[model samples]
Target: MACQDSDTARLIDVELDESVGRGTPDVEHERAVAIFDLVEENSFRPVGDSGEGPYKLKLSLVEARLVFAISRENGEAVVTHILSLTPFRRIVKDYFLICESYYDAIRSATPSQIEAIDMGRRGLHNEGSQTLMDRLKDKIDVDFDTARRLFTLVCVLHWRG
Candidate 1:
């Protein structure tokens, strides 16, 4: 629902389901489908699974959430299903980069996303880490320092991989 139509999000398929929801057919969408395949849970890793053929994409709506899957079908992503369930939601580097590319993505996030982020960041910081920028002679926004730290942290994570 957070997605907009101005982007390359294309509807791929629709199918009926007896489980999960009522008579709502699963509506498959292929916006940044590659995103799903590229990001892994927690560890934030990318594993190449691109192989020959028709890419079958599926989405199922269960419990008021959207769930999707991808597979090859005929040298294309033939999304075969759609479900409503959010599971194995991973935060990979691509997701991070995607989020960074469009800061608006975060800015427009729903209340749930904000809460999720807040919950995830719990205990990741220490007390008194927050500080106001003091007037320094060099005169650079400390925000830049935060960015640098994030970049270095990503580099270190990749290096460890």
Candidate 2:
């Protein structure tokens, strides 16, 4: 979907907490790409009269809770939402497992095998995205694709290695 100039309900900047250590180069690459894609096209609007147009977001994990710190394009403070990560733990674990399998399969497994693992990976990803959307329903309004990309960043923050 094309973003209109009048559509001030999109995100222009997204930042992850520095405390969340970056893992491998692959993980870093994934983080970078997710940020780029999210900034390029996203629909994020804080529910209520928080602020206006083209917001900035900071995602972090604090005391096992996921924090979403939002601000205006000019750095003005907006609403901050802290969500429990309990809903995501199992799905994130499953996603990581499927991702590991997909990575290994890409090395020597047949194309069909790789595809099968990838399918599972996408399924878990979708589940996580839906969960995220549901959790944020009361605090923020985001499209499905935007939720998917945001969910990717959420997974990145959960990376322990």
The root-mean-square deviation over C-alpha atoms between each candidate and the true structure, in angstroms, is 18.1, 2.4
Per-residue lDDT of candidate 2, residues 37-134 (tens digit): 98998888888744577899988778879889999989988889999999999999999999989989999999999998999999999999999999
What's the distance in Å from true for residue 78, model 2? Answer: 1.3
lDDT of residue 21 for candidate 1: 30
Task: TM-score each candidate.
Answer: 0.22, 0.89
Error of 2 at 143 (Å): 0.4
lDDT against the true structure, each candidate: 0.29, 0.86
Q: Per-residue error at 152 for model 1, in Å?
A: 37
Residues 1-161, candidate 1, lDDT per residue (tens digit)?
A: 11122122222332223332332121122222322322211111002332332223343445544333444434344232232222212223434444343455467888777666554433122111121112111221223233223223222222212
Q: After superposition, how far is residue 149 of candidate 2 from its true place, in Å?
A: 0.2
- At residue 129, candidate 1 shows an lDDT of 13
